[model samples]
Target: MTSTARILIVEDEPKLVELLTLYLEAAGYACHAVYDGNHVDEALTSFKPDLMLLDLMLPGKDGLTICKELRQHSQLPVIMVTAKVEEIDRLLGLELGADDYLCKPYSPREVVARVKAVLRRYQPQAPAAASTTSGVHIDETRFLAQLDGVTLDLTPVEFRLFALMTHSPGQVFSRDQLLTLIYDDHRIVTDRTVDSHIKNLRKKLEAVRPEQEVIRSIYGVGYKFEEGSV
Candidate 1:
Protein backbone atom coordinates (compact mmCIF):
# COMPACT_ATOMS: atom_id res chain seq x y z
CA MET A 1 0.00 0.00 0.00
CA THR A 2 1.09 3.60 -0.58
CA SER A 3 1.76 5.08 2.81
CA THR A 4 1.81 8.59 1.45
CA ALA A 5 -1.49 8.36 -0.38
CA ARG A 6 -3.80 11.27 0.49
CA ILE A 7 -7.50 10.67 1.14
CA LEU A 8 -10.00 13.50 0.91
CA ILE A 9 -13.03 13.16 3.16
CA VAL A 10 -16.03 15.10 1.83
CA GLU A 11 -18.83 14.71 4.33
CA ASP A 12 -21.07 17.30 5.97
CA GLU A 13 -21.14 15.41 9.22
CA PRO A 14 -18.23 16.55 11.32
CA LYS A 15 -18.31 13.57 13.65
CA LEU A 16 -18.33 11.14 10.75
CA VAL A 17 -15.46 12.92 9.06
CA GLU A 18 -13.52 12.92 12.34
CA LEU A 19 -14.05 9.21 12.76
CA LEU A 20 -12.98 8.51 9.17
CA THR A 21 -9.91 10.69 9.51
CA LEU A 22 -8.82 8.93 12.66
CA TYR A 23 -9.12 5.49 11.12
CA LEU A 24 -7.44 6.44 7.85
CA GLU A 25 -4.64 8.25 9.55
CA ALA A 26 -4.03 5.25 11.78
CA ALA A 27 -3.80 3.15 8.64
CA GLY A 28 -0.94 5.33 7.38
CA TYR A 29 -2.92 7.42 4.92
CA ALA A 30 -3.00 11.21 4.82
CA CYS A 31 -6.47 12.64 5.41
CA HIS A 32 -8.07 15.93 4.37
CA ALA A 33 -11.58 16.87 5.36
CA VAL A 34 -14.21 19.16 3.82
CA TYR A 35 -17.68 19.77 5.24
CA ASP A 36 -19.29 21.07 2.07
CA GLY A 37 -19.35 19.98 -1.56
CA ASN A 38 -18.62 23.54 -2.60
CA HIS A 39 -15.13 23.27 -1.16
CA VAL A 40 -14.32 20.04 -2.96
CA ASP A 41 -12.85 21.73 -6.02
CA GLU A 42 -10.52 23.92 -4.02
CA ALA A 43 -9.52 21.03 -1.79
CA LEU A 44 -8.85 18.89 -4.86
CA THR A 45 -6.55 21.52 -6.29
CA SER A 46 -4.79 22.18 -3.01
CA PHE A 47 -4.62 18.74 -1.43
CA LYS A 48 -4.27 16.72 -4.63
CA PRO A 49 -5.82 13.65 -3.05
CA ASP A 50 -5.24 10.15 -4.29
CA LEU A 51 -8.81 9.23 -3.43
CA MET A 52 -12.00 10.87 -2.24
CA LEU A 53 -14.61 9.79 0.29
CA LEU A 54 -17.67 11.56 -1.05
CA ASP A 55 -21.07 11.89 0.58
CA LEU A 56 -24.12 11.73 -1.68
CA MET A 57 -25.90 14.55 0.09
CA LEU A 58 -23.93 17.69 0.81
CA PRO A 59 -24.63 21.30 1.68
CA GLY A 60 -23.61 23.05 -1.56
CA LYS A 61 -23.47 20.48 -4.39
CA ASP A 62 -24.47 16.84 -4.47
CA GLY A 63 -21.80 14.13 -4.44
CA LEU A 64 -23.12 12.71 -7.70
CA THR A 65 -22.62 16.04 -9.42
CA ILE A 66 -19.12 16.36 -7.98
CA CYS A 67 -18.29 12.85 -9.07
CA LYS A 68 -19.63 13.46 -12.56
CA GLU A 69 -17.61 16.63 -12.90
CA LEU A 70 -14.48 14.98 -11.59
CA ARG A 71 -14.72 12.15 -14.11
CA GLN A 72 -14.64 14.59 -16.99
CA HIS A 73 -10.83 14.92 -16.86
CA SER A 74 -9.49 12.92 -13.92
CA GLN A 75 -9.63 9.27 -12.97
CA LEU A 76 -8.89 9.99 -9.34
CA PRO A 77 -10.42 7.23 -7.30
CA VAL A 78 -13.70 8.01 -5.52
CA ILE A 79 -15.57 5.93 -2.96
CA MET A 80 -19.07 7.20 -2.34
CA VAL A 81 -20.70 7.38 1.09
CA THR A 82 -24.44 7.54 1.20
CA ALA A 83 -27.43 6.78 3.37
CA LYS A 84 -29.61 5.81 0.43
CA VAL A 85 -29.73 2.09 -0.26
CA GLU A 86 -31.64 2.31 -3.52
CA GLU A 87 -30.39 0.35 -6.52
CA ILE A 88 -30.66 3.38 -8.78
CA ASP A 89 -28.42 5.35 -6.45
CA ARG A 90 -25.81 2.61 -6.55
CA LEU A 91 -25.94 2.42 -10.33
CA LEU A 92 -25.77 6.19 -10.61
CA GLY A 93 -22.69 6.32 -8.39
CA LEU A 94 -21.01 3.66 -10.49
CA GLU A 95 -21.94 5.45 -13.69
CA LEU A 96 -20.46 8.64 -12.28
CA GLY A 97 -17.14 6.80 -11.82
CA ALA A 98 -17.10 5.98 -8.09
CA ASP A 99 -14.60 3.22 -7.45
CA ASP A 100 -16.52 1.83 -4.52
CA TYR A 101 -19.19 2.83 -2.00
CA LEU A 102 -20.31 2.44 1.59
CA CYS A 103 -23.88 2.57 2.74
CA LYS A 104 -24.73 4.59 5.79
CA PRO A 105 -24.31 2.96 9.24
CA TYR A 106 -21.14 1.27 7.98
CA SER A 107 -18.22 0.38 10.22
CA PRO A 108 -15.25 2.68 10.19
CA ARG A 109 -12.95 -0.30 9.87
CA GLU A 110 -14.90 -1.45 6.87
CA VAL A 111 -14.39 1.96 5.35
CA VAL A 112 -10.66 1.61 5.88
CA ALA A 113 -10.72 -1.82 4.33
CA ARG A 114 -12.63 -0.57 1.30
CA VAL A 115 -10.20 2.29 0.89
CA LYS A 116 -7.30 -0.14 1.01
CA ALA A 117 -8.95 -2.40 -1.55
CA VAL A 118 -9.49 0.45 -4.01
CA LEU A 119 -5.96 1.71 -3.55
CA ARG A 120 -4.56 -1.77 -4.04
CA ARG A 121 -6.37 -1.99 -7.33
CA TYR A 122 -4.68 1.18 -8.60
CA GLN A 123 -1.36 1.14 -6.81
CA PRO A 124 1.52 -0.22 -8.85
CA GLN A 125 3.57 -2.95 -7.31
CA ALA A 126 7.32 -3.18 -7.70
CA PRO A 127 8.22 -5.32 -10.70
CA ALA A 128 11.84 -6.35 -11.30
CA ALA A 129 12.03 -5.98 -15.08
CA ALA A 130 10.06 -4.56 -17.99
CA SER A 131 8.74 -6.47 -21.01
CA THR A 132 7.91 -4.97 -24.37
CA THR A 133 5.05 -6.21 -26.55
CA SER A 134 3.86 -4.58 -29.72
CA GLY A 135 4.27 -0.83 -29.13
CA VAL A 136 3.58 -1.06 -25.42
CA HIS A 137 6.10 -2.13 -22.81
CA ILE A 138 4.87 -3.47 -19.47
CA ASP A 139 7.02 -4.08 -16.44
CA GLU A 140 4.98 -6.74 -14.70
CA THR A 141 7.15 -6.83 -11.62
CA ARG A 142 6.99 -3.05 -11.31
CA PHE A 143 3.36 -2.85 -12.37
CA LEU A 144 4.06 -0.31 -15.09
CA ALA A 145 2.72 0.10 -18.60
CA GLN A 146 4.29 2.37 -21.17
CA LEU A 147 2.95 3.20 -24.61
CA ASP A 148 5.53 4.62 -27.00
CA GLY A 149 7.76 5.33 -23.98
CA VAL A 150 5.01 7.21 -22.13
CA THR A 151 3.55 5.80 -18.94
CA LEU A 152 -0.08 4.72 -18.88
CA ASP A 153 -1.97 5.12 -15.59
CA LEU A 154 -3.67 1.73 -15.64
CA THR A 155 -5.68 0.32 -12.79
CA PRO A 156 -4.77 -3.21 -11.74
CA VAL A 157 -7.59 -4.71 -13.79
CA GLU A 158 -6.58 -2.72 -16.81
CA PHE A 159 -2.95 -3.81 -16.42
CA ARG A 160 -4.00 -7.44 -16.23
CA LEU A 161 -6.19 -7.04 -19.30
CA PHE A 162 -3.44 -5.37 -21.30
CA ALA A 163 -0.88 -7.92 -20.15
CA LEU A 164 -3.08 -10.85 -21.14
CA MET A 165 -3.89 -9.42 -24.57
CA THR A 166 -0.29 -8.45 -25.23
CA HIS A 167 0.84 -11.97 -24.42
CA SER A 168 -0.69 -12.94 -27.76
CA PRO A 169 -1.48 -9.87 -29.76
CA GLY A 170 -4.21 -10.20 -32.40
CA GLN A 171 -5.79 -13.14 -30.59
CA VAL A 172 -9.45 -12.36 -30.00
CA PHE A 173 -10.82 -12.95 -26.51
CA SER A 174 -14.44 -13.19 -25.46
CA ARG A 175 -15.71 -11.02 -22.64
CA ASP A 176 -16.07 -14.08 -20.43
CA GLN A 177 -12.49 -15.10 -21.09
CA LEU A 178 -11.26 -11.60 -20.37
CA LEU A 179 -13.33 -11.40 -17.20
CA THR A 180 -11.98 -14.65 -15.83
CA LEU A 181 -8.44 -13.62 -16.64
CA ILE A 182 -8.79 -10.22 -14.98
CA TYR A 183 -10.42 -11.44 -11.80
CA ASP A 184 -8.94 -14.44 -10.05
CA ASP A 185 -11.05 -14.16 -6.91
CA HIS A 186 -14.16 -15.59 -8.61
CA ARG A 187 -16.24 -12.59 -7.60
CA ILE A 188 -19.65 -12.33 -9.27
CA VAL A 189 -19.58 -9.76 -12.09
CA THR A 190 -21.48 -9.05 -15.27
CA ASP A 191 -20.34 -8.50 -18.86
CA ARG A 192 -21.06 -4.80 -18.38
CA THR A 193 -18.39 -4.66 -15.69
CA VAL A 194 -15.85 -6.02 -18.13
CA ASP A 195 -17.05 -3.59 -20.80
CA SER A 196 -16.76 -0.66 -18.42
CA HIS A 197 -13.16 -1.48 -17.60
CA ILE A 198 -12.38 -1.91 -21.27
CA LYS A 199 -13.91 1.45 -22.06
CA ASN A 200 -11.85 3.16 -19.36
CA LEU A 201 -8.68 1.42 -20.54
CA ARG A 202 -9.28 2.53 -24.11
CA LYS A 203 -9.84 6.10 -23.00
CA LYS A 204 -6.61 6.18 -21.00
CA LEU A 205 -4.65 4.80 -23.94
CA GLU A 206 -6.26 7.17 -26.41
CA ALA A 207 -5.37 10.08 -24.16
CA VAL A 208 -1.73 9.38 -24.96
CA ARG A 209 -2.15 8.40 -28.59
CA PRO A 210 -5.36 9.56 -30.16
CA GLU A 211 -4.63 7.97 -33.55
CA GLN A 212 -3.55 4.52 -32.43
CA GLU A 213 -6.16 1.87 -31.79
CA VAL A 214 -4.13 -0.41 -29.55
CA ILE A 215 -7.03 -2.59 -28.50
CA ARG A 216 -9.46 -3.50 -31.19
CA SER A 217 -12.98 -4.84 -30.93
CA ILE A 218 -13.72 -8.18 -32.63
CA TYR A 219 -17.42 -7.28 -33.04
CA GLY A 220 -19.45 -10.10 -31.51
CA VAL A 221 -16.36 -12.04 -30.49
CA GLY A 222 -14.66 -9.66 -28.01
CA TYR A 223 -11.37 -7.76 -28.33
CA LYS A 224 -7.74 -8.12 -29.38
CA PHE A 225 -4.60 -6.04 -29.18
CA GLU A 226 -3.65 -4.88 -32.62
CA GLU A 227 -0.42 -6.52 -33.69
CA GLY A 228 2.45 -4.36 -35.04
CA SER A 229 0.88 -1.19 -33.69
CA VAL A 230 4.01 -0.51 -31.70
Candidate 2:
Protein backbone atom coordinates (compact mmCIF):
# COMPACT_ATOMS: atom_id res chain seq x y z
CA MET A 1 0.00 0.00 0.00
CA THR A 2 1.12 3.56 -0.65
CA SER A 3 1.69 5.16 2.72
CA THR A 4 -0.07 8.45 3.32
CA ALA A 5 -2.41 7.94 0.36
CA ARG A 6 -5.65 9.69 1.27
CA ILE A 7 -8.99 7.92 0.77
CA LEU A 8 -12.37 9.63 0.89
CA ILE A 9 -15.24 7.38 2.01
CA VAL A 10 -18.76 8.40 1.02
CA GLU A 11 -21.24 6.28 2.91
CA ASP A 12 -24.30 7.10 5.02
CA GLU A 13 -23.95 4.13 7.32
CA PRO A 14 -22.14 5.15 10.47
CA LYS A 15 -20.87 1.69 11.36
CA LEU A 16 -19.67 0.96 7.86
CA VAL A 17 -18.00 4.34 7.71
CA GLU A 18 -16.16 3.73 10.96
CA LEU A 19 -15.18 0.24 9.96
CA LEU A 20 -13.79 1.31 6.58
CA THR A 21 -11.93 4.22 8.08
CA LEU A 22 -10.40 2.04 10.78
CA TYR A 23 -9.29 -0.55 8.27
CA LEU A 24 -7.84 1.91 5.79
CA GLU A 25 -6.12 3.93 8.48
CA ALA A 26 -4.56 0.79 9.88
CA ALA A 27 -3.25 0.09 6.40
CA GLY A 28 -1.54 3.53 6.43
CA TYR A 29 -4.11 5.41 4.36
CA ALA A 30 -5.49 8.71 5.59
CA CYS A 31 -9.28 8.39 5.58
CA HIS A 32 -12.03 11.01 5.52
CA ALA A 33 -15.75 10.25 5.82
CA VAL A 34 -18.73 11.96 4.21
CA TYR A 35 -22.28 10.91 5.06
CA ASP A 36 -24.14 12.80 2.39
CA GLY A 37 -23.51 12.69 -1.33
CA ASN A 38 -24.18 16.42 -1.46
CA HIS A 39 -21.13 17.04 0.72
CA VAL A 40 -18.86 15.11 -1.60
CA ASP A 41 -17.87 18.05 -3.74
CA GLU A 42 -16.89 20.07 -0.72
CA ALA A 43 -14.94 17.18 0.79
CA LEU A 44 -13.15 16.53 -2.49
CA THR A 45 -11.85 20.06 -2.54
CA SER A 46 -10.85 20.02 1.10
CA PHE A 47 -9.45 16.52 1.29
CA LYS A 48 -7.87 16.21 -2.15
CA PRO A 49 -7.84 12.49 -1.61
CA ASP A 50 -5.90 10.17 -3.90
CA LEU A 51 -8.93 7.90 -4.28
CA MET A 52 -12.63 7.91 -3.47
CA LEU A 53 -14.76 5.05 -2.13
CA LEU A 54 -18.19 6.21 -3.21
CA ASP A 55 -21.29 4.46 -1.90
CA LEU A 56 -24.04 4.07 -4.48
CA MET A 57 -26.72 4.93 -1.95
CA LEU A 58 -26.50 8.25 -0.14
CA PRO A 59 -28.61 11.01 1.29
CA GLY A 60 -29.07 14.30 -0.61
CA LYS A 61 -27.34 12.96 -3.75
CA ASP A 62 -26.87 9.49 -5.18
CA GLY A 63 -23.55 7.87 -6.04
CA LEU A 64 -24.34 7.57 -9.73
CA THR A 65 -25.11 11.27 -9.98
CA ILE A 66 -22.05 12.17 -7.97
CA CYS A 67 -19.87 9.98 -10.15
CA LYS A 68 -21.41 11.31 -13.33
CA GLU A 69 -20.91 14.88 -12.21
CA LEU A 70 -17.39 14.25 -10.98
CA ARG A 71 -16.37 12.75 -14.33
CA GLN A 72 -17.26 16.00 -16.04
CA HIS A 73 -14.07 17.67 -14.82
CA SER A 74 -12.06 15.34 -12.60
CA GLN A 75 -10.24 12.08 -13.19
CA LEU A 76 -9.98 11.24 -9.51
CA PRO A 77 -9.76 7.49 -8.99
CA VAL A 78 -13.17 6.17 -7.91
CA ILE A 79 -14.31 2.79 -6.61
CA MET A 80 -18.05 2.32 -6.28
CA VAL A 81 -19.20 0.72 -3.04
CA THR A 82 -22.72 -0.60 -2.88
CA ALA A 83 -24.97 -3.47 -1.86
CA LYS A 84 -26.46 -3.60 -5.32
CA VAL A 85 -24.77 -6.50 -7.10
CA GLU A 86 -26.87 -6.35 -10.21
CA GLU A 87 -24.83 -6.73 -13.39
CA ILE A 88 -26.42 -3.66 -14.94
CA ASP A 89 -25.50 -1.45 -12.01
CA ARG A 90 -21.93 -2.63 -12.11
CA LEU A 91 -21.70 -2.03 -15.84
CA LEU A 92 -23.28 1.40 -15.45
CA GLY A 93 -20.80 2.33 -12.77
CA LEU A 94 -17.90 1.30 -14.99
CA GLU A 95 -19.31 3.20 -17.94
CA LEU A 96 -19.54 6.23 -15.65
CA GLY A 97 -15.76 6.07 -15.03
CA ALA A 98 -15.46 4.09 -11.81
CA ASP A 99 -12.01 2.52 -11.42
CA ASP A 100 -13.42 -0.44 -9.50
CA TYR A 101 -16.58 -1.69 -7.76
CA LEU A 102 -17.14 -3.44 -4.44
CA CYS A 103 -20.37 -4.97 -3.22
CA LYS A 104 -21.55 -4.83 0.38
CA PRO A 105 -20.92 -7.80 2.72
CA TYR A 106 -17.34 -7.72 1.50
CA SER A 107 -14.52 -8.09 3.97
CA PRO A 108 -12.63 -5.03 5.12
CA ARG A 109 -9.43 -6.86 4.24
CA GLU A 110 -10.68 -7.25 0.71
CA VAL A 111 -11.41 -3.56 0.56
CA VAL A 112 -7.90 -2.75 1.71
CA ALA A 113 -6.49 -5.13 -0.86
CA ARG A 114 -8.57 -3.50 -3.55
CA VAL A 115 -7.53 -0.05 -2.45
CA LYS A 116 -3.94 -1.18 -2.75
CA ALA A 117 -4.62 -2.62 -6.19
CA VAL A 118 -6.18 0.54 -7.58
CA LEU A 119 -3.47 2.78 -6.15
CA ARG A 120 -0.75 0.51 -7.40
CA ARG A 121 -2.14 0.68 -10.92
CA TYR A 122 -2.57 4.42 -10.77
CA GLN A 123 0.66 5.31 -9.04
CA PRO A 124 3.23 3.05 -10.66
CA GLN A 125 6.47 4.90 -11.29
CA ALA A 126 8.53 4.72 -14.45
CA PRO A 127 10.71 1.64 -14.45
CA ALA A 128 13.80 3.07 -16.13
CA ALA A 129 14.27 6.57 -17.51
CA ALA A 130 11.71 8.67 -19.32
CA SER A 131 11.86 8.37 -23.10
CA THR A 132 10.00 8.96 -26.29
CA THR A 133 9.87 6.94 -29.49
CA SER A 134 7.65 7.12 -32.53
CA GLY A 135 4.83 9.53 -31.66
CA VAL A 136 4.53 8.49 -28.04
CA HIS A 137 6.19 10.26 -25.12
CA ILE A 138 6.24 9.10 -21.51
CA ASP A 139 7.66 10.57 -18.32
CA GLU A 140 8.13 7.83 -15.76
CA THR A 141 8.65 10.20 -12.87
CA ARG A 142 5.43 12.06 -13.60
CA PHE A 143 3.43 9.12 -15.00
CA LEU A 144 2.64 11.25 -18.00
CA ALA A 145 1.83 10.13 -21.54
CA GLN A 146 1.52 12.31 -24.59
CA LEU A 147 0.69 11.30 -28.12
CA ASP A 148 1.69 13.70 -30.89
CA GLY A 149 1.82 16.50 -28.30
CA VAL A 150 -1.68 15.94 -26.85
CA THR A 151 -1.85 14.51 -23.36
CA LEU A 152 -4.07 11.46 -23.01
CA ASP A 153 -6.67 11.30 -20.26
CA LEU A 154 -6.07 7.61 -19.66
CA THR A 155 -7.44 5.64 -16.76
CA PRO A 156 -5.07 3.64 -14.56
CA VAL A 157 -5.67 0.48 -16.56
CA GLU A 158 -5.43 2.28 -19.88
CA PHE A 159 -2.21 3.96 -18.95
CA ARG A 160 -0.61 0.72 -17.83
CA LEU A 161 -1.67 -1.04 -20.99
CA PHE A 162 -0.34 1.70 -23.22
CA ALA A 163 2.97 1.87 -21.41
CA LEU A 164 3.51 -1.88 -21.55
CA MET A 165 2.70 -2.25 -25.23
CA THR A 166 4.64 0.84 -26.23
CA HIS A 167 7.66 -0.30 -24.25
CA SER A 168 8.12 -3.22 -26.59
CA PRO A 169 6.82 -2.71 -30.07
CA GLY A 170 6.04 -5.60 -32.44
CA GLN A 171 6.11 -8.18 -29.66
CA VAL A 172 3.00 -10.31 -29.56
CA PHE A 173 1.50 -10.62 -26.10
CA SER A 174 -1.21 -13.07 -25.16
CA ARG A 175 -4.09 -11.80 -23.06
CA ASP A 176 -2.67 -13.64 -20.08
CA GLN A 177 0.77 -12.22 -20.70
CA LEU A 178 -0.57 -8.69 -20.92
CA LEU A 179 -2.69 -9.16 -17.81
CA THR A 180 0.27 -10.16 -15.72
CA LEU A 181 2.28 -7.21 -17.00
CA ILE A 182 -0.54 -4.82 -16.20
CA TYR A 183 -1.63 -5.90 -12.71
CA ASP A 184 0.76 -6.85 -9.93
CA ASP A 185 -2.05 -8.08 -7.71
CA HIS A 186 -3.56 -11.50 -8.27
CA ARG A 187 -7.05 -10.39 -9.32
CA ILE A 188 -8.98 -12.77 -11.56
CA VAL A 189 -10.22 -11.09 -14.72
CA THR A 190 -11.62 -12.61 -17.88
CA ASP A 191 -10.08 -12.20 -21.32
CA ARG A 192 -12.93 -9.86 -22.14
CA THR A 193 -11.64 -7.51 -19.48
CA VAL A 194 -8.35 -7.20 -21.32
CA ASP A 195 -10.09 -6.86 -24.67
CA SER A 196 -12.38 -4.14 -23.35
CA HIS A 197 -9.42 -2.16 -22.03
CA ILE A 198 -7.58 -2.56 -25.32
CA LYS A 199 -10.60 -1.27 -27.18
CA ASN A 200 -10.60 1.78 -25.00
CA LEU A 201 -6.89 2.38 -25.44
CA ARG A 202 -7.17 2.08 -29.19
CA LYS A 203 -10.05 4.53 -29.23
CA LYS A 204 -8.08 7.08 -27.27
CA LEU A 205 -5.07 6.73 -29.49
CA GLU A 206 -7.18 6.84 -32.62
CA ALA A 207 -8.88 9.98 -31.38
CA VAL A 208 -5.52 11.71 -31.55
CA ARG A 209 -4.28 10.02 -34.73
CA PRO A 210 -7.04 8.53 -36.78
CA GLU A 211 -4.75 7.50 -39.61
CA GLN A 212 -2.49 5.48 -37.37
CA GLU A 213 -3.31 2.09 -35.90
CA VAL A 214 -0.82 1.25 -33.20
CA ILE A 215 -2.12 -1.99 -31.77
CA ARG A 216 -2.89 -5.01 -33.92
CA SER A 217 -4.76 -8.13 -32.86
CA ILE A 218 -3.33 -11.57 -33.64
CA TYR A 219 -6.41 -13.72 -33.93
CA GLY A 220 -6.28 -16.98 -31.99
CA VAL A 221 -3.13 -15.69 -30.30
CA GLY A 222 -2.86 -12.17 -28.81
CA TYR A 223 -2.01 -8.54 -29.69
CA LYS A 224 1.03 -6.47 -30.52
CA PHE A 225 2.08 -2.85 -30.85
CA GLU A 226 3.37 -1.57 -34.17
CA GLU A 227 6.05 1.04 -33.78
CA GLY A 228 5.85 2.27 -37.34
CA SER A 229 2.10 2.51 -37.37
CA VAL A 230 2.04 5.90 -35.72
lDDT of 2: 0.82
Q: What are the runs in model 2 whose C-alpha is more than 4 Å off?
A: 68-75, 86-95, 122-128
Assess every candidate by TM-score. Answer: 0.61, 0.83
lDDT of 1 by residue, 83-195 (tens): 86664344432556676657898889888887887777676666534555656788776666888788887655677888888878878999999877654435456777678
Q: Taking the candidates one at a time, how many backbone clashes does each contain?
A: 4, 0
Model 2, 1-230: lDDT tens digits are: 26899999999999998999999999999999999989999999999999999988899999989988997788788888878667434453255667777888899999999898888866755476554568788765565788888998776667777888888888899999877765556777668767877887888889998877778999999998888887
Q: What is the lDDT, from 0 to 100, of the residue 45 in candidate 2?
A: 98
RMSD (Å) per prediction: 5.3, 2.8
What is candidate 2's CA lDDT for residue 139?
69
